[model samples]
Target: MNPAMNESSHTPPLVEISGLCKWFGEFSALYDINLQVNSGERVVVCGPSGSGKSTMIRCINQLEEHQAGTIKVDGREVMPGMKQIEEVRRDVGMVFQSFNLFPHLTVVENLTIGPIRNKLVSKTEATERAMHYLERVHIAEQADKYPPQLSGGQQQRVAIARSLCLQPKIMLFDEPTSALDPEMIAGVLDVMIELAEGGMTMICVTHEMGFARRVADRIVFMDFGEIVEVAEPETFFNSPRTERAKLFLSQLLGH
Candidate 1:
């Protein structure tokens, strides 16, 4: 997986980060980050807690502004106040650890609101679009119910459907299954795997080693505010290049 920064010969990568850095007052959250994700690539990022994995993906979608470095989506730089920022955001869907669904809104309403309000889609069209994705995530039967009426796994699937309603070109998952009960984790991961198989350009920050191994084209390992390793799943799992990666795998895999 040629992740070089310069791929001007063909269509540019879907997402690119060069020398990215982030700081929060006295603490540095990320340092000198560089990575490129091409179209239809599934990149899984894993690391210990407080290791900047979430911060890095959050930076990609502009949920967290970086202090330094360039992040380009479809070759357009992501900045705090860029005129095209909204356009960029519309094309990039983010699913968080928390469901973040509005309790007052029905599942379908939660999904339709974004497209209707932001994209000027008609309510009927939005609802139809919402249901289409709801079915995709295997939660269409829960469409008329409120988020609080569903289980954790169902709620998270609704969140996934909401993101899909926008028909985003890229999807970012931030520890999506972390908040779920152990049994619910597989349902969310199943939906994610299906999404990956459908050729979504995905950047997932997850600790689910099985999902990472099954879906990721490359595994990005981060620690102490820096990316320490990048390798395919087999190589990373069996023979990590760095001591930090080795220790992280051992701890996570219980070896």
Candidate 2:
């Protein structure tokens, strides 16, 4: 085993990407991307709106197919085949900007579906897991409510719990708090911070510099479909290596 792997045996980065590139029609969405997250590393990706941060992560779970290069999760390559893609997605859970809960299902039901479908756990066992995660996210009381009945932050927390119910090795968040109100943002961030403290591998795309500063082991900055800088959060924030990164940070922190 690698020395790094020996030190952290619990959740060492179950995923890695190298030379990853993605294109839409003629426009490139990602270029020569390289990133490695140790089993439980908390990585925050920040960049301007069109910087491709979302696209890079979307490729990891095969949600957005990459045109070239390799993506490996839990040491398994993510390929074009449906079985491969489904397996990768089963181990990696994603939370979106807009909470993607099922309107027809109750909160508890939404959480139970994935595990039941993928793991074939009995409904009773799945509900047990769903409720566990719901309590973890502080929404156990709302388990019977429908998605439309909850607040945005509550809905997002449910979404997080739903993913956790799958027992994914890594969690991906794409602008999770973007649609939340200021007061509610803290509640969601609190749960995320707790998850990080417990050593959950995470890759999050958000403009919340405060959350990045507190939780990120490293910060990745991308621009024009390419990574411009990857550094410790302090270094990335205090002295960005690239001019593009500097400009982007300036606009974000200036406000």
Candidate 3:
């Protein structure tokens, strides 16, 4: 077993994407993307700009429609216009590059919206749950403040707390730290590391190699919409097989 995924187990896949293809008009954004994330595994997807790392994760939750192939969440195939998509999405939590919190709502209110609307949680109950996650993220004091009133790191913490309120089975992060300033990145990654240590099944699209090596069970590299390589972090960073992957890692680690 690779040291990166010391506790990695061969359980059934929680999220499976096979032969997945996506396009924007005439341009293909993903080409035959395939991946499977097992329960309690944390996979980090890395690539250069325009490499479709974000698009691939988006397809897992149907945020971006795919043109071909299958995405199964917890054994149910995800199909557009299918009623099960809502049910599947309810169990999947996503955090985007931007902290998409409602600026007008207080931090706690932002966290409560999804559970109250979809989970049928009582306002009082939702607030309590929100506070729990906020505390977990080390930002309970910011709960009553509005998104705009907090720093970038604080707002992103609120976003994470909001997702946790939904109690998702799988968490997807699309460049969650990319938008933050250098100093603020550590705070978000710290929370993500905590989540990983707690055995959360997670897939993150990020360039943060330190986080990938320290917390990821596997590192998946993509280029030109193709999954170039997938391996445990030690092998991937130290001895990538594919030239594309080696070049990509050299560029990243050499900096």
lDDT of each: 0.91, 0.90, 0.89
- Residue 166, candidate 2: Cα error in Å is 0.5
Give the Cα-based TM-score of candidate 1 against the true structure.
0.95
What's the best-to-worst order under lDDT?
1, 2, 3
Clashes of 1: 0
Candidate 2, poorest ten consecutive residues by summed lDDT = 1-10
Query: In the order shown, what is each candidate's alpha-carbon RMSD?
Result: 3.0, 2.5, 3.0
Q: Kindly list the per-residue Cα lDDT of model 3 for residues 181-241, writing each as its tens digit.
A: 9999999999999999988889999999999999998999999999999999999988899
lDDT computed for candidate 1: 0.91
| Steric clash count of candidate 3 | 0
Per-prediction TM-score to the true structure, in the order listed: 0.95, 0.95, 0.94
State how far residue 94 of model 1 sits from its true place (Å): 0.3
Ranking by TM-score: 1, 2, 3
